[model samples]
Target: MRIEIVEGDITVRPVDAIVNAANSSLLGGGGVDGAIHRAAGPELLEACRELRATKLPDGLAVGAAVATPGFLLPAKWVIHTVGPNRHAGQTNPALLASCFTESLRIADGLGARSVAFPAVSAGVYGWDARKVAQLGIEAVRAYAGRPLEGEKPMVELVEFVLFSEETAGIFRQALEESGGGPG
Candidate 1:
C-alpha cells in the first residue's frame, strides 16, 4: 500500500473514495463533514437521508462507518465515520484508531483502490492533532500490513488530506516515526 500526506481539500481528490469525519447524524455538520456535503451537492444529502430513514435510523455510532456515493465530488464514494468527541469525555485512542480502520474496511469492501482521509476528531471534536495523527497513521499502517482473510488488500493508496500545513507536518512526522517513511 502507498500512503501519502497532502495538504489540500479532500473533496477535490480524485480517489475512488474519500472518508468524511462526520457526526453520528450523517446528515452533515461543520468542518470536513459540511465541506464534503456541500461538494457532493444535494444528492449526497438525499442519499444520507435514505440511510437514516432505513439502515441508520438511530444515527451512526462513533468509530463505525457507512458509505455513500459521492454525487458531485471528485471521488466516487464517500465513507462516513463518526469520530469520538473529546469534549464528551471520550478519550480512548482506540476509538480514534477505529475511525481509520473502519473506513478502510468499508473502502476495501467497495473495491476502492485509493482513498483520501481528513484528520478525524482533530477539529471541532477537540482531539489533539499530534495524537490523532499518531493514532490514525498507526491504524492505517497496521491495517495495511494485514491482508483481509487471505485476500489481497483492495485499497492500495491512503492519502491524508490535511487542511493545513501544520497538520500535514504532524501527520508526516507521525508516519515517519511509525516507520512508514514519510508517506
Candidate 2:
C-alpha cells in the first residue's frame, strides 16, 4: 500500500474512488463539497437525495459513507463521508478519524484499488490543518500499509489532496517527522 499527499482537487482524481467531505444533509455546499458536486454533475445530487430519503441516523456523525456514481469524475465512484468540526472539541477526534476508517472500509468492500481524499474537515468544518494532518497521516498509515483481510485488491494508493500550499506543507512536515507516508 502507498499513501500520497498532494495539493490539488480531489474531485478530479482518476483513482477508483474519491472521498467527498460531505455534510449530514448531503446537499451541495461550498468549498470542496460544492466543487465535487459541480464536477460530478446533477446526477450525484439525485443520488444523494435518494439516499437521504432513507432516513439515516442523527448524530451518526463520521465514517458513515455512501457510494454514488462519479458522473463527470474520472473515478468510478464517489464516497461521501461527514467529518466533525473542531468546535465540537478534542473529544471529537475519533469522529473525524472514523471518516477515514469508514471511507476505507467502503472502498475495501467495493474492491477499490486506489482512493483520493480531501482534507475532510479543514474547510467549513473548521478543523486545524496541523491536527487534521497528524490524525489523517496516522489513519492512513494504520490502514494504507495493509490491505483488509489479507486480500490485496491491489489497494496500493491512498492520496490526501490538499487545496492550499500551507496545508500541503503541514501534511509534508507531518509525514516527514513521523517517517510515515508513501516513499
Candidate 3:
C-alpha cells in the first residue's frame, strides 16, 4: 500500500473512505468527530447511536461505513472506528494501531481504492507525536501486505491527515528514517 502523510482537513477529502476520529461512545463528540458528524448531518448520529446500542466494548473496532448523504461531504462512506482515550499514560498504542488496521480491513473488503485517516488518538488520546506516527505507519505497513477480504491483494493507498505542520514533519521524518532502516 502507498502510505502518505499530509496536513489538511479530513472532512473535505474526496477519497472513497474517510476514518472518523470517533469517541468510544460513537455518539460523535468534539474535535474531528464533531466536525464529521456536523458535516455528515443528523442522520449520522442516528445511525451511530444504533451501532452503539449493541453494547460494543471500547476496544472493539468495526467498519463498510454508512453513507452520509453526498450533499455535504464528497466521500461515499465514513468508516467509523472507536479510538481509545488516553486519560493518563495507560493508553495502548497497539489498540490504536488496531483501529487503523481494522478500518483498512473493512475498506479493503468493500473494494475501496483510497482511504483518508486522521491522526488517530493523537489529538485527544495524548499519544506522543513521534510514537503515534510510528505506530500509524507500522499499522499501514502491515495492512499494506495483506489485502482486504475477497480482494486480489492490491496496494491500498492510505493518507494520514496531520492537523499541524509539526505532526506532518514528524511523520515524514519517521517514515523516511524507518523506510531506510528495515522497518
Candidate 4:
C-alpha cells in the first residue's frame, strides 16, 4: 500500500473513501465530525440518523466502523469510526489502532482504491500525538502486510490528512521510523 501524509481537510480529499474520526453517535459532533457533516450537507446527517435509528440504535462502539455515502463531499464514501476517547479513560492503544484497521477493512469491502484518514483520537480526545501517529501507521502497515486470499488488496492508497504541519511531521517521522518512508 502507498501511504501519503498530507496536511489539509479530509472532507476535500478526492479519494474513494474518507474516514471520519467520529463520535460514538455517528450523527456528528465537533472537530472533523462537524467539519465533514457541514461539508457533506444535511444528507450526511440524515444517513447517519437512519443508521442510528436502525442498526446502531445505541450508537457505534469505540474501535468499530461503518460506512455511509459521502453525500456532498469529494469522496465516494464516508467510513465513520469511533476512536477510543482517552479523556473518557479509554487509553488503550490497541483500541485506537482498531479504528484504523476497521476503517481500512471497510474501505476494502467497498473496493476503494484510496482512502483518506484523520489523526484519530489525537485531537480533542486528548491522546498523545506521537503515540497516535505511531499506532495509526503501524496498524495500517500491519494490515497491508497481510496477504489476502487469492486477490490483491482492494485499498492501495492510504492518505493521512492531518490538520497541521506539526501533526503531519509526527506521522511522517513515524512512517520513516517504520521503514515506510513518507510518501
Highest-scoring model, TM-score: 1
Tens-digit lDDT string for candidate 1 (83-111) = 99999998999999999999998999999
The positional error of residue 41 in candidate 2, measured at the CA in angstroms, is: 0.2
Better of 3 and 4 by lDDT: 4
Regions of model 3 farther than 4 Å from truth: 54-71, 148-151, 180-183
lDDT of 2: 0.81
For model 2, give the 10-residue run with minimal summed lDDT.
54-63
Candidate 3, 65: how far from true, in Å? Answer: 9.0
Q: Whole-model lDDT, candidate 4?
A: 0.91
Write the residue-wise lDDT of candidate 3 on 21-86 in tens digits: 776567778888898898888888877766666555342343223323323577777877766667
Residue 180 error, candidate 4, Å: 3.8
Q: Which pairs clash (backbone N, Cα, C closer than 3 Å) in model 2?
A: none
Among all windows of ten consecutive residues in candidate 3, which has the lowest summed lDDT? 62-71
lDDT sort, best first: 1, 4, 2, 3
Local accuracy of candidate 2 as per-residue lDDT tens digits, 13-74: 88999998988888788888899999999999988887777765352356577788889989
**Predictions in order: lDDT:** 0.93, 0.81, 0.72, 0.91
2 or 3: which has the higher lDDT? 2
What would the per-residue lDDT of candidate 4 be over residues 1-183, giving only the tens digit for each residue?
Answer: 999999999999999999999999897899999999999999999999999999999999999999999989989999999999888999988999999989988998899999999999997999988999899988998888773453667888999999999999998898898886853
Preferred candidate (TM-score higher): 1 or 4: 1
Clashes of 2: 0
Q: What's every prediction's RMSD, in angstroms?
A: 1.0, 2.1, 3.6, 1.3
